[model samples]
Target: MKINFQGAEIHYSIAGEGEATVMLHGFLESSEIWEEFLPEFSRYGKIITVDLPGHGRSGCLDEIHSMDLMAEVVLEVMKTTGVKKANFIGHSMGGYVGLAFLEKHPGMLQDFMLLNSTPQADSEEKKEIRDRSVELVKRNKPAYVTMAINNLLSPKNTGKFSEEIEILKERALKFPTRGITAALEGMKIRTNKTEVLKSFSGNKILVAGRQDPLVNIKELKQLAEESGCGFISFSGGHLSYIENKVQFIKLCISSKK
Candidate 1:
């Protein structure tokens, strides 16, 4: 279904029934990415999957869709669906949105987990990389999406998931350059949320990938330990939900602190 927000259409899907649980997908991905796991996840509670602004069927709301803006969109979805409080699971960029949500709407969150994501802001070097990616997307979107999705997977599994990679690329290619650049710009400016994690009064989980190229697993593990949040790791890369589905599901299910 779609919710009209700020003159843009925000696409979302709802399944099953019980305590609400929201699932937010990463960059270049849509709510569809969670389709395979929805049935199983819904067994736990009502699962709501959302397409971030400028992603999937959702429309871009601004030139730069900040993490805070995306969080507000999620909040609107919850309100539309009559969800007062819900657990959250966010992957990559989606995790950044989750932290922003916590910062602004603390009372609405029952708990949250960051999957292959961090509470830290983008480093200068990473911001430079995002700048480069923005330019690349403007010049050659398809090529950039292919390379970006490939880089998200573990090198060892690239060949193993070639067909899956192709599908992902096709979906990512549908994103407009404007949306892509806006997302990159937003990510470049996000503030460090480590303190947000430390001060949260409810449960939190930090799931990292041993071979993740995008996140520093050691640093994230340290943050999790320091903040007293549960930490889990797997032999995979950034896309642990795809690379290690079974274990990832178990970890998420057990994250209800």
Candidate 2:
């Protein structure tokens, strides 16, 4: 269904009942990524899947120019859907959005599951990468974004699952250029949330790919270790959840219970 927020429409889906679980997809992806796994998760509790502004069916947002704005969009979704609190699961850029949400709206989340994402801000090199990405996107649409994402996974993952990777690439190609611009801009300017991680009070799980280059696995481990949160790993790269979804779902359900 569509929920009107700030003149833009956010599309979302709801399934089952019990404590709420919100599934947030990464940049250039939509709520549809959860289709294969949401059914299994629904057996555990209420599942809410949302299309963040500029992604999926949630079309063109007027004011969503930062990660903080993305978080506000999520809060707006929760309010519109009548979810007072929820357990949040986010991957990649979605994790950044989740962090922004937690920083701005603390009491609204019961617990969090960060999948293949980091709370650290961009380093100079990372900033340069994001800057180049912005220029590349402007010059050639989503080709750069898709190519960058493909590189985030292992060779085996891509070679064996070429079709899946191609599908994601195609879907990503449809992402609004302006929206991608907004998201990249957010990444460039976002502050480090390491302090926010320390302040987190709820049950948390940090899931990472053993080969993820975008997010340092050691840093992820340090965050989980320091925060006393559970840390789980898979054999793939940045898109570990998609590559190894069985373990991903297991971690999500197990963490909730």
Candidate 3:
């Protein structure tokens, strides 16, 4: 469904019932990425999945687009859906948004989960890569999406999760070139949320992949230690949820309780 917010339509999927639980997908992904385990999450409460602006079927804004803006878009979805407070589960860029949401709107989160994501800003090297991705997407869209998927998976998990990666690639290939540029720009300007995560004194969980290159286990361990949140590791790459849905849901359920 579309939630109208500040003249932008936010696309969201609502499933099951009871308390609310929101799921935010990573960059180049839509809420549909959670289809496989929506039923599982729904068993605990209503499961909400959202497509951040410039992704999936959501509309974009010409205003200052940042991770905080994305979180506000999500907040609007919650208000419109009558979800006073909900547990949040975020992946990659979505994790940044989750931290942003906590910083800006702490009262709305009952519990938060960071899955295969981190609070640190990209390094100078990583920032350069993001800049290049924007340029490449504008010049050759398919190659940009293809290369992105290639970099996201670890070599060992590549062959094992190739089919899942292809599914995500399809989602990326469908993105608007201009939207991808906007996303990269948003990523570049996002504030380093390490402090936000550290200062957040609330119920939270840290979930990491054993083989995730982007946010290594060491980084997640540090976050867990610094923030005093429970941490769990699964066997997979960055896309742990795709490869280990059972363990992911189990950890989420256990952490919240």
Give the number of the best model, judged by lDDT: 1
Q: Candidate 2: where are CA atoms >4 Å away?
A: 62-64
RMSD of candidate 2 to the true fold?
Answer: 1.5
**In candidate 1, which residue pairs clash?**
none
Q: Give RMSD (Å) of candidate 3 vs. truth.
A: 1.6
Q: Identify the candidate with maximal TM-score.
A: 1
User: Per-residue CA lDDT of candidate 2, range 56-84, in tens?
Assistant: 87877752368888888888888987899
User: Cα deviation of 163 in candidate 2 (Å)?
Assistant: 1.4
| TM-score list, all predictions | 0.97, 0.95, 0.94
| Model 1 TM-score on a 0 to 1 scale | 0.97
Report the candidate with higher lDDT, 1 versus 3: 1
Note each model's CA RMSD in angstroms.
Answer: 1.3, 1.5, 1.6
Model 1, 1-257: lDDT tens digits are 99999999999999989889999999998888899998888887899999999998889989899999999999999999999999999999999999999999888988898999999999999999999999899899988998899998888988887887788889888887788888999999999998988889888889988999999999999999988898989988999998898998887676432
The 0-to-1 C-alpha lDDT of every candidate, in the order given, reads 0.91, 0.84, 0.83
Single out the weakest 10-residue window by summed lDDT for candidate 2.
56-65
Candidate 1 vs candidate 3, TM-score winner: 1
Q: Candidate 1: RMSD over Cα atoms? A: 1.3
